[model samples]
Target: MPHDEAQARDTYACRLARSLHNQVSTLLGNRLAHLPGRTTPPKSVHTTQLKMALAETVFRKVYKLGLVPKIIAKLPVLSLMLAVISVCWLLILPMDGQFRHTYISENALMPGQVNLYFRETEWNHVRGFRDEAAKWDFESASRSNPQLEGWLSDFGLKVSHHHDPQTNLSTMYALMHAPRGDNTEAMVLVAPYFTSDGQKNVGAMALAPALARYFARMSIWSKNIIVVFPQNGHTALRRWVDAYHTTLDVTAGSLEAAIVMEYPSEIDNFSFMEIVYEGLNGQLPNLDLLNVATTIARHENMQVSVQGTAPQNLHKNDYWTRLEVLARGILKLAVTGVNGKLHGCEAFSGWQIQALTIKAVGTGGPDITQFGRIVDSSFRSVNNLLEKFHQSFFFYLLLSPTHFVSIGTYLPSAAVIALLFVVSSIYAIARGVSAADFVASIGSVLALFFGIEAICLVGAISLQHIAISGTESSGAFYVITAALMLFTVLSSVGIFAVKAPRFSRPTSFLLLAFALYFIAMLIVTLLIVHFALAFCIGISAFPLTLVQDLITKTHGNTLVSMKARVKVVLCLIASSPVTMIVLLGYILDGGKTEGVLGLVQGLLSSWHEMQSWTWFVVALGWLPAWISVVVVCAFGDFTSLEKEKTE
Candidate 1:
C-alpha cells in the first residue's frame, strides 16, 4: 500500500512540473511571435535579452544584500577620508618631487645674463644721496619735494607731481625715455618716501636717483624707466598709479613692471632681500618676474627670503621648515588678498603691471652695491621683455625662493575643501527633503536664509558707503557701531526664530543645507581669484558641517547632553568669522587690542580706497553662514520649550 502511494505522489509531481514547463514554453513562444510577414528575431537579440535578465537578477541579489544602502550610509565617512587625503596631498607638496623647481617661463627674461655695472661708484652716490635725504624735514614734506624734483631734473628726465586731496599726500615721478626705442612701454622704480614701517626710507630715496642716474646713461634700454617717490604710504602709491593711468600731467608708454625699493635704514648693508610679491586682491606678479628677481639676487651672492622665511632655512629644505614656509606663504597670501594692505607692490595691481617689493632685511651681509646690482639686473631683464608679462604663472605659492607650487597643483587643495562643503550640503539637502514637512521646511528655509542675507547685504552696502564717505576715525567708529548693531539684531532674530514653537527638524536641516551651499559657492568663486583666502576660509569653516549631525541627534531632546553642549560651543567658536579675525589679529600682533582695531581699520580703508571685497565677503558671505549654523545648532533643535508649552 505504501509503495503504491509513493508511486502515485511521484507521478502527480511529474505531471505538475510538466504542466508548468509547457505553460512557460507557450508564453515564451507567444511573446516572441511577430505579426504576419514580419522577420524572425535575431540570435543576438535573444543573447542580449538573456544577458540583461542575468544582470537584473544579479542587481536584485546585490540590492537585497543592502550593499548600496551601506555605501550611501558611509558616504560621509568616505567624503571625510577623501578630504583628509586631499589635505595630505596638499601638505606633502613641500617635499621633493611634489613641487616644481621654478624656471624662467618667459624666455625673454634672461636674468643675471648681463654684466651688472652698479658697483662702488654707484654705492658712493647712494651714500651721498642718503645723507642728503636724511637731512630733509620729512615731517612737513607734502605736495612737493624740491630736492627730489631737482635731482631727477638733473638726471635729464621729465619730472611730474600729483597731489591727492583725500590723503593730502603727494607723489613725485620722473620719466626717463629710452634713448633707442619708442616710448611705448615703461618700467617703474618706486622708492616711497616712507618705508612700510612708516620710517624714513633714506636708502631707497638715495638708491632711486642713483639708479636713475645710472639708467639715464645706459643706451641699451628699450622701455622707458620711471623713478617714483610716492609720499605718505601705500595710499599715496595707489593715488600715483591711478593718476598715472588716468590723469597724469606727464605720461609715458603703457606701464609693464614695477620694482619697489624699501631700504628704510640709512646703513647701506643688509643680510638678505625679502621679496614681497603678494598683491591686492590676491593678485600676483608674473612668476617669471619673481624668478628673475630671486635669480639675480642669488647670482649676486645675496641671500633671498620670501614671506618672512629666513634665507638660511630655505636651503636646508627641512620638512618642518618647508611646511612652515608653505603655511606662512598661504597665510600671508590670504591676509594680503583679504585686507589689500599696501605692501608697496600691491599698489601696482589692477593695471596689468607686474610689481614686487625688494626690501633690505637684517644688516651687514651684503652692501648696497649688491642690492643695486639685483635691481639693475632685474630692470634689465624686464627691459628685455617684448610684451606684457604673459608667459609665466600669475598664481603660485612659493615654498622657497627657489621652489614653488603652481596653480594647477595647489588649486585642487582648495577645490577638495570646497568639495567637503558641497558634500555636507548635499547630505543635508537629502535629509531635509525626506522630512515629513519638506515643502513647508523649504519655504521657511528660503525665507529665513534670504531674509537674513538681504539684511546682511544692506548692512554691507551701508558700511561700504560709510567707509567711502566718512573720515577714517568717524568711519571706523560708525562701522563698528553698525556692525555691532547688525550682529545684535541678527543674533536676536536667529535665536528667536529657532526657539519658536513651530520650528521643526526639517527647518533646521534645510537651513543648514542652505548655508552650506552658500559657503560652498562662495569658496568656489573665491578659488579662482584668491586661492589662499578660499582655502583658509574653507578649512576654518569646516567645523560647521558637524553642526548638522549634532542638531539631528539633539533636536526635541528635553535636556541636551554635556558632550553635545561642548560640541555646540566648539562649532560656534571654530566657525565664527569674528573669532577668526580676532585670533588672526592676535597671532599677527601679539594679542594687542590695537592690532585688532588696526586690522578692522585696514579692512575699512582697503574697501574705501581700493574697493576690495574683503569686507563684503566677511559681512555678507561668512558672517551669514556662521550665524545660520549658530542658529540651527545653538537654538533651533532644543524642543524643551515646545514640550513645556504643550504641558
Candidate 2:
C-alpha cells in the first residue's frame, strides 16, 4: 500500500470517530437536561424544547376545537347522559345511607318542646261545631254560618265576615291580636267550609273555631293568629287572600305562614296524614315549615307520610316501593302548578306566603280531639319561630317524612332533558335551512295548533250548543267527546293542508326540530324556575320527539300510508290533552269514574272561565311541536335532502 493512501484513510477514520463522539455527547446532554429534578440546562437542549413547544401548541388547538359548533352539536347526547345520571341520583335518594334525616334548620323553631293543652273540652267544642254545621244546607251554611260566627266571637277575638257579591260566596276570619308583638306579621289557620271535593268539612270547620278560642287565651304568642273560614276550597281562598292583600276594609298584615286543614265529614278519623307542601306553580314553602310541622305531628305519635303513603321501614329491602312513592310525589308536585284544587294552600303561594295543606283521608284512628293536639303542637312550634322562614330548603321532594331530595340533587335530571332539546334545535338551525323557510314551516304548524286550540276553547265556551237534554253527567261527556272529535277532524284537515314541496321538506323538518328545541328550552327554564310543572310536562311530552322520525319513515308527499296514519294516531293519542287528563285523573282521583269525567269537565270549564291557562299552554305550546313533526313526516324527501346537501 502507498504511504499517502494509508495516511488519508487514517485521517478520515479519525475525523469520523470525532464526529460520532460529538453527536453522542449532544444526545446525552439533551437526555440529562430533560431528566426529572435536573435544574440546569444542557448546551444542546433545543430538540427537547422544540418537542415540548409543539405538544403545548397541539393541546391549545385541541382545546379551541372543543368550543366549535360541531362539538356543540354533541351536547344533546351529553345532556341525555346527564339526565340519566340525575334520574339515577333521584332514585338513590331513597337508598340506605343516601339521605340525611330532616332536621330543624331554624334554631328558633323549638318544635315539640312545648306541652299542648287541648283535651276532652276541645272535643266537646268540636262536637258542638259539627252539630251546628249539620243544621244548615250547603248554600245557607256557605253564605252565613252564624253559629260559627257566634262561637268565634265568644272567644273574645274580633270577628269579621267577607262577602263577594261577584262570586256569591262568603268568608269569615277572626283575628287574635298578638300580646308580645305588633300586628305587622301574622300566621293564618284556614278552615274551608267545604272540602275541595264538595264534601262538608265536619272536623276542621268545627275544630278551628275552638282552637282559635284556645289560641286567643295563650299569652306567649308573638304573632297574631287569624282563623279563616272560606265558603269553598280554592276559589274562596283566592278571593279571601286577594281581599286581604288588596282591600283596606279588613285590617291585616303580611302573612308569614299558613296551614289549611280539610277534615271531611265522611272521615271520622285518619290513621295518618300527608303533608302537602307543593303549592301553585310548583312553589314550595321554606323547608323549615315542613320540618317543624312534621316534627310536631310525630311528637304527638301521629304517623307521618308524604304524597298519601306512609313511609316503609324495610331498610334497603323496599327500594322500588320508595322510588315509586318518590316518583308519585314528583308527579303531584308537577301537577300542583296547574292551579288545581288539589291543595288549598295553592292560593296563598301566589302571594309569596308559605303555605301547606293537611288533608285527612280515609277515617280510622285520630279523631278531632287527637288531631287538635297535633294542630296545637304545630302552632306552638310556629310561635317559637323568631323570624320568617329563610334557612331551610325551599326546593325539595319528600320521599318519606324523613328522607328528601333537594333541588341541587334533582334539578340536573330535568335540566339535562331540556338541554337535549336545545342542542337539537341549534343543530336544526345549522343545517343551512333559510330562516324564511323555517318561519313559513312553523307558521303552518302553528296555524293548525292554534286553530285546534281555538276550536276546543270555543266549544268549551259554547257548551250550550250541545242540546243533549239528558242527564248532566252523560250530557257533559257527550258534548265534550263530540267537541274533541271535531277538534281532531279539524286538526287532521289542517295537517293535510300544510303539505310542503320537495325543496321545502328539509326546511320544514329542521324548522320543526328547532321548534322542539325551543320548547325544550322553555321546559328547561320551567324545570329550573318551576320544577314540578317542567317535569310533569317534560316527561309526558317526551313522545313528541319520536314523531319526526316515525313520520319520515312512514310517509312520502302524503299521509296516505297506513303506517303514517298509525303514527299520526299514536302521536295524537300520546301527546293530546286527553292523555294529560287521564294522567291527572289517575293521580288525583285514582281513576274513579267521577274523577276522569269530572277532571275533563273542570279543565274545560276552567279554561272557559280564564281561571287556568294550563290547558291552553298544553294545547298551544305542545301541539305546535307535535304537528310540525307530523308535517315533516308527511312531506319530506330524504333522497332529495341529501342530494341538495351534497350540491
Alpha carbon lDDT of residue 527, candidate 1?
93
lDDT per residue (tens digit) for residues 397-437 in model 2:
77667777788877877776676566556644444344566
Model 2 deviation from the true structure expressed as Cα RMSD, one decimal place? 13.4
Candidate 1 yields a Cα-based lDDT of 0.75
Per-residue alpha-carbon lDDT of model 1 for 197-231, expressed as tens digits? 77888888888889999999899999999888887
Model 1 is weakest, by summed lDDT over 10 consecutive residues, at: 638-647
Question: Which parts of model 1 have CA positions greater than 4 angstroms off?
Answer: 1-63, 67-69, 311-315, 337-341, 435-444, 467-471, 474-501, 555-560, 634-647
Worst 10 residues of 2 by lDDT: 638-647
What lDDT would each prediction earn against the true structure?
A: 0.75, 0.66
TM-score (C-alpha) between model 2 and the true structure = 0.77
